[model samples]
Target: MIMKATGIVRRIDDLGRVVIPKEIRRTMRIREGDPLEIYTDREGEVILKKYSPIGELSEFANEYAESLQQATGHVVCISDKDNIIAVVGASKKEYMGKKIGKELEKIIEEKKTIMVDQNADGKIFNILEEQEGDSSYLSQVIAPIVSQGDTIGSVVLLSKESQVKMGDVEKKLAETAANFLGKQMEQ
Candidate 1:
């Protein structure tokens, strides 16, 4: 495991509450009212993990990605705010559990649906940082998943074949999947 020492320290208040530094919180994407899971190892090290509601639906996301891939004959991926949780396609191994790129994070924050093609710009934004500057995809559709007025995740449809064009149909499919996933979170 990789560990970094921030050299920052805090003390528990009278109520046993320790304030997380603002810089660390921003870097970890911890917002106000967000749930965090606290854990302590036998080694006496404490850990905090940002809880992801969409992560709890990993099974459902996988099933949905598979169905979407079959229906559209394209790559399908589902991601929570920070990482890709499910992927269905030949490239599954390349993306599963990968941290999402900043562009994808921005889309989730804006709660936007976007369709992009290789020819539109010099190169499409990387879906994951590991694939930065790689333009192997021919087309892509991205839709943000929002639940209870909060954007939580995204659904993506991607085509690697030049013959396959992503159009309104693919956009609608991605949007529908995103909407469905968002609704599932409410239950």
Candidate 2:
């Protein structure tokens, strides 16, 4: 059976019991007795996640990327284990789930730079000034969605050289993303 990002068939009965697909359970490290957390986004996006920091952050980053694309006209790229796992608000899939081991991946590896680690709480925002191809500095905001001393993933906000700002609304949204991640990591 092929795994899809969406379109997992589920039916909720009157008693409210939902069956999770075996594939999802296995990939998320969810055992028979393992705990799961459910969350609803502002757009009423319902999601079920494992109680691991990695799992929660992954979910938060994906959604946050979508939100950033909506608010700003920049492409949001999310990576995990040096692989670009998801791409949001971009015209083309520049680096979706692409394993970063050769060029860019090497740079990230050498930096040993972690935007936010696990146990990151509240609205923590950091702006990184990255040198662009034109020898200009472009700022990007990276916020990690953390829970239970683990970092599931991160939210990346991209903007032009002069338009990058981690404002109040962006900070709150990042916090909410983290909260959602935390809730998912709960039992």
Candidate 3:
């Protein structure tokens, strides 16, 4: 006995956009151009079904972007070598405007990764040391966005000037942004 998987196939328009029937979409858990798997039976009957597979990581970068914004005491910037790609949080504009923020350049020229100052707490985020400012009391963190054996870009965060020491919470947030950005570039 062949159980029919019933669904309506609306025709494609001039722009090549097709509207699948609502019931079919709901039944198959389809959401707009979600690729369908099709086949034919012995009697040349068409079979349509949904193909479910996890997609690339960049597909959900927005979720991470939102989280980055929610994160406290930090200005996050996702950037490529040439320019800033995306900035999440209030201080994004200020961080992105600086051209010397490319951390990878220093990594290449110095042939070493600059270590974060252990006593450094909540102030500003910088990809490279441009000027010697007394923002040492400012909480800041930066992570190089590297994926698939290549250094794509970097992310940065400035800690809030609260009594809270720059602990695991701030470190985790910075790391998450960096990891998410690296995943985005990989895709």
Index of the highest-TM-score prediction: 1
Q: Write the per-residue lDDT of candidate 1 for residues 5-43, one digit (tens) a residue.
A: 999999999998999999999888788988899988899
Better of 1 and 3 by lDDT: 1
**Backbone N/Cα/C clashes per model:** 0, 4, 7
Worst 10 residues of 3 by lDDT: 51-60
Give the RMSD in angstroms, all C-alphas superposed, for model 1: 2.2
What are the per-residue Cα lDDT tens digits for candidate 2 across 1-187? 2335757888998999988888877555456755567887797777775443343356565776687677766556655433455567653344564443333333333432223222233222222223123212244445554556544444455544454554556555545654564556565
Score candidate 3 by lDDT: 0.51
How much lDDT does candidate 1 score? 0.89
- Per-residue lDDT of model 3, residues 130-187, tens digit only: 5345354355555665666555555555444545455566667766666666665566
Ranking by TM-score: 1, 3, 2
For model 2, what is the error of residue 76's alpha carbon versus the real structure, in angstroms, after optimal superposition?
Answer: 2.7
Score candidate 2 by TM-score against the native.
0.43
Best by lDDT: 1
Q: How much does candidate 3 score in TM-score?
A: 0.48
- Reference-based lDDT, each prediction: 0.89, 0.50, 0.51
TM-scores of all predicted structures: 0.88, 0.43, 0.48
True lDDT of residue 65, candidate 1: 93
Give the poorly placed runs of model 2, Cα more than 4 Å off: 1-64, 99-137, 161-164
Clashes by residue pair, model 1: none
